[model samples]
Target: MHLDPAIDGFARYLATERGFSVNTVRAYCADLCGLATFAEERAVGTVDGLTLELLRDWLWEGTQAGLARATIARRSASARGFTAWLTRDGVLPSDPAVRLRSPKPGRTLPRVINRTQMQDLLDKLEVAASTGDPGAVRNLAIIELLYASALRVSELVGLDVGDVDLSRLTVRVTGKGDNERVVPFGVPAQTAIVRYLQAARPALAAADPGATRSGTKPSGSALFLGSHRQRLGVRAVYRLVAALLESMPGTGPAGPHALRHTAATHLLDGGADLRAVQEMLGHASLGTTQIYTHVSAERLQQSYRLAHPRA
Candidate 1:
């Protein structure tokens, strides 16, 4: 089979059969597309023409081009998956990428905000929110919920009004691969959310008078809204978190995930159980959640260096 048709079939299989997320499928397709272009440049156009040597050379070229190790590792996985699928579908006699390998991505500690800095940030936001600006109020609520629940931006924006139980102080989040989990938040987050719902949301919703007149609520039951009263998007949440973190002291990426990392590290620092934190984070693996333990240990070491008297 031609590589193009085989790649398309593999992508469809990932989406419809494997139930991969849209972003995951897109990444897989992108890697394979790159491989296809590489193969075509080398005059290899069919699935059968994809050799183990060719796969290694493609990854080598990516390394030479200075692509991140993570990107190369992902591309290797994509090629392996594609070749395995081709073999299974009788398009190839054997998988050429069976022995394909890429360098393991280095692990770096996620950026965490110190408790004092976090407190000061929240205080400033609360003060701004007191002015009753709809955007300000909503921003406070968004940040509060993000810190309290450690939610991914996609999960945060995907929330609906019915997904939140203000009385129970919990939210139903649909995470990666459409997995659903109810995460709990504290009293402060509850207060912020209640304020947003009662004050900010209604005002933001009313900003689009045409939606009300047309009898079509553009915002629908979305828990958050843009200024135009439409459902909030991932990019908007990113910009809000990025702007807030830009002035703060941090070395890692200034994005919503930083807030998530801070929340997890803070929870671990406060003696939260590892498995429980994993559940709250909606992380499928306890190993993934263990990174925050490392963060907490590093913080403890920093404090000890600063305060201890012994040489």
Candidate 2:
């Protein structure tokens, strides 16, 4: 009947039964703990003491404290999910958060690089790759594959040496929820990847001579290695992409995911099937893939405004 035990059980359920990613499970746990703190303040010591009113009051308090709408909505969702789990697990006779509602967060358009700007960016990388510097070659390969395949940064870093099929010009990536898919890259990406694998990778692996004697060569089965010869972290990828996008015009995030948005938007702009992009991106829902269409339309309107002179 303890709240902590129930929370622990729910966390396990999310991780084991629901197959949620580690970060997602952590967020759910943290949100639920916030609710527990509120409940304890009201002298409610167990899961059974939760009520719909209490849940609403918690959200109201957040609003009074000037919490962002997104945070309040996420907390509401956490409560609903946790209470529903309790009812199903017989911790409660009925769900208390069945009617919980929260304010919707505003949706902003994703930043997308137009074809011309994208080309100009790659032109710079292409020039750098001509130097045959291992870092330059690897950077060219990473950005090319990222733009071509619309891969998440995690999937790009998570790739193994054998995951890439050079002959087929495809890379096998594991997306969210461990959904695996083989996505084809264009000839440019294929060329960069081939060069990196053949020359740059060996050069990087050998860069750390101490790894041979220390046996610390493989910190992970990562396709992309940091200067330390370890798996490249997502923060490093964010830093890399952010620096490249420092001068680019955009509103939303400037991380590696912006490359993903650009790839999907470009595919839609080039008349690719919506469903095909969905499959390639490994999105579980078709609606999630439709954002690119909106981006494409916004681009079209801008192009028309700039080029049309009838007004």
Candidate 3:
């Protein structure tokens, strides 16, 4: 089989048998495709022809090309997974990547927005909405929901009209791995959503008014709509959040995920149970959630250093 065909088959196997997420499958494909390209340039034709020396050469080439350590490490992991799979399936006699190694990547903590900055952003959003612009209302709702529910940008944009229950102040979000969770928001988010539904959605729908809607018909069933009245995409949500942060003072180089980190940290700061915060953040491991405790502890230390006189 051609390399591309074999790679396609392996991707299908990952999706169906291993149940990897789409993002993971794409990363695996990109990594293996790079290797295939390198092999093709050297006239290598089959998986069995792969060797540890060839893998090392590939890593050296990547380093020569100035790829970051994180990228090189991920590529090594991808190669190892593919070679192990091929060996297990009898496509390769041995796993050449078992001996391949890459440099370790530095651990970077997630960026989090402070509570005052978050509140300032929300206050600015509210002021923008009072200008009678419907888009302002929609933006306000998006920001509020993001910070309130600690949603991934994908989860936020994937929301449909029925996913929100304003009366109960809960939103049903489809998280990573397609797992669905109902997360509650505070009154601010609920209020923002209500205003958007009442004032903004109709204006947004009216601008397009495509075959997708009418006086009724639930306004096309998307909770967030683009200017063209289609489902809002992840990129749009990202740009909106980035623009909001750019206009704020004392904000760091944070994105929508920063809002999520801020929400999770604040929940822990407010005495929410660690496991409950984990569930709300859709983290598969409590260890991931426990990082917020470290953030909280650092904040407490800063407070003590500023308040105490005796050192």
Candidate 4:
């Protein structure tokens, strides 16, 4: 089969058979598409024309063009998976990527907000929410739940009204791979959520008349709605977080994931178990969770350097 058609088939397989998330499938397809373009430039457009040399040359070209190690590593993985699938499906006689290798990406510690900064930020939000502005109230609830639950923005925005258990202070989060887990939150988050639901949500929902005209409830079951009274999107949440963190001291991304990192690190600093943090993070590998341990150790060293008299 042609490489383009083969990539399309692989994408379908990833979505239907492998149960990969939409973003994962999209990323895989994007990498394959880039590979396909490169192959076409070399007049090797069919799957049969794909060889190990071509794959290596492609990665080499990416490195020469100054692509980050992480990007090159991801591309290598994408190619390996594609060729393996092709081999299994009889599209290729053998996997060309079996011998492929890429440089390992260096692991950087995630950025975390200090306890004092996080508290100050939350206090400011609380003051804004007290004015009874629906947007301010909803924003406060969003940040609280994000910090409390350590949820990915995707999971946070995907939440439905029925997913939250206010009485138990737990939220039913559908994480990556459609895995469902009930995560507990603190009283502050619970209070913020309750306030949003009671006052803010209704006000926002009333702004959308289309749903009512169509004989459906405004905002439907979405736990968080946009100003348009539709389910909130990931990009909106990213913008919200970025704006809030703009003036704050931080060296990494200012997205909602920063809150997740802060929450996990804070939990570890407070003596939470590693395995429990892993579970809360929905990380399949313990090694991923162990990175936070390193973060905590770094913080300890910093404190020791500043406070100890033996410096």
Candidate 5:
């Protein structure tokens, strides 16, 4: 079969058989398409004709093109997936990408804000909300809930009014893979959310009631609204967080995920159990959550060196 046709078949297999999400399918398809184009440029026309030499050359060309290590690694993984599937389905006698390897990228510890810095950021948000700006109130609620819940940007923006239970102080979040988890926040986030819902959300909703019917409810169900009173987008959230970080000092160029890392690390530093933090962050593996333990250990070492008398 032609390479393009085989690629399409594999994508369908991933979607139907493996039940991959649309984003995953699109990413895999893009990687495989790039590989197929590389192979075609090298005069290899069929899936069975792909060889290890061609695969290596493709990776080399990607490197030459200045692809980041992470991107190259993903492309290599895509090649392996395609070759393995072809061999398994009897389209090829062997997988050419079995031995293909990309350079391992260095694992930099995630950047987290210190406790004082976190307090300062929240203090600023509180001050902004106190100005009686409805948008400021909503922004404070957004930042508070983001840090408190350790939620991904998508999860935060995906929130609906019904997803939160102010009485219970819990939020029902649909995380990655559509997994549902109820997470709790403290009084600060609760206070901010309450203020936003009561004082800010009404003004936001009134700005664009969004296609209402006589005696029927308005269509604005999103918890966060854009200027157009539409659901807040991920980029807008990113821009807001970035702009907030610009006024704060002594922090890296980290985005909303930094807040998540900081929140998780702070939980661990405050003597919260590791496994509990893992569940709260919605991480599937406890191993992934163990990074915060390292963060805690480093902090402990710093304190010990500063306070201990022994040389």
Candidate 6:
């Protein structure tokens, strides 16, 4: 089959069969689009025309262009998945990417804001929220709940009013694979959420009626709403989190996930159980949540060096 239609079919398979998220599907689509362009240049227009050698050369070109090892690695994975799928579907006689490999990206420790920094950041937001601006109030609630619950940005935005049980100080979020988990937050988050629901949410929901570009009805059930009264976009959350973390000392990503990392690390530092942290984080594997242990160790070493008089 032609590469274009084959790529489309692969995307649907990812969404339906693999249950991949929209962002994952989009990333795969983009990476495969690059492969498609490269294949076109080589006059390899069909799925069967793609060779392992071409795949390697495309990754090599990415490396030559100084793309990060992580990016190249992701591209390699995308190509491997595409070829394997095509082979399984009988479009290709064999998987061309069977032996394809890319350089493994180095594991960088996640950035975690210490408790003091987190407090100061939240304090600043609280002061801003004192102005009673709906967005500012919502922002405080967002960061509070994010730190308190360690929620993924998608999960945070996907929340509905009914999902949160303010009386119980817990929220039900549909995480990856549409799995639901009820995560608990602290008293601060509970208070902020109550305030937002009572004072800010209604005001935000009653925002401009003409802002219907997202095709979502204004004043929808989304827990977080933008000025348009529609569910807040992921980009808005990213922009807010990125701006907040920009001034922090960090070598890694400064996205909403950083707050998650910070939250997990803080929990571990406070002697929270490893398995408990994993469950709270909605991690399927205990191994995935162990990274926060490393962060805690590093922080402990830093504190020891700073406080201990011995060389």
Number of the predicted model whose TM-score against the real structure is largest: 4
lDDT score, candidate 6: 0.91
Residue pairs with backbone atoms closer than 3 Å in model 1 (clashes)? none
lDDT of 2: 0.88
TM-score of each: 0.95, 0.93, 0.88, 0.96, 0.87, 0.94
The sequence of per-residue lDDT tens digits that candidate 3 reaches over residues 142-168 is 999999999999899889989999989
Question: On residues 13-90, what C-alpha lDDT tens digit does candidate 6 reach at each position?
Answer: 999999888989999999999999999999988888888889999999999999999999999999999999988888
Per-residue alpha-carbon lDDT of candidate 5 for residues 1-311, written as tens digits (9 for 90 to 100): 78999999999998888876567789999998988888888788889789898888888998999988988888888889999999999999988889999987545678788899889889988999999898899999999999998998888998999999998999999886677899999899999999999989888777745543346544477888766666787899898888877766645656888889889999998989998888899998998899889888988898899999982
Model 4 Cα lDDT, one tens digit per residue, 159-191: 999999999999999888888888999999999
Compare candidates 1 and 2 on TM-score and give the better one.
1
Model 1 CA lDDT for position 34:
95
The 10 consecutive residues of candidate 5 with the worst lDDT sum are 210-219
75-144: candidate 1 lDDT, tens digit per residue: 9999999999888888788889888889998789999999999999999899999999999999999999
Reference-based lDDT, residue 100, model 4: 99
Q: What is the lDDT of residue 282 in candidate 1?
A: 90
Tens digits of lDDT, candidate 2, 1-311: 87888999999998889888777889999998988998999998899899999999999999999999999999999899999999998889999999999999756789888888899889999899999899989998999999999999988988998899888989998877767899999999989988998888877776665654355555445788777777777888889889889998767788999999999999998899999999999999998898889888988898899999962
User: Given candidate 2, what's the lDDT at residue 298?
Assistant: 84
Local distance difference test, per candidate? 0.92, 0.88, 0.86, 0.93, 0.86, 0.91
RMSD of model 5 against the true structure = 3.7
Comparing 4 with 6 on TM-score, the higher-scoring candidate is 4
What are the runs in model 3 whose C-alpha is more than 4 Å off? Answer: 209-219, 247-252
lDDT computed for candidate 3: 0.86
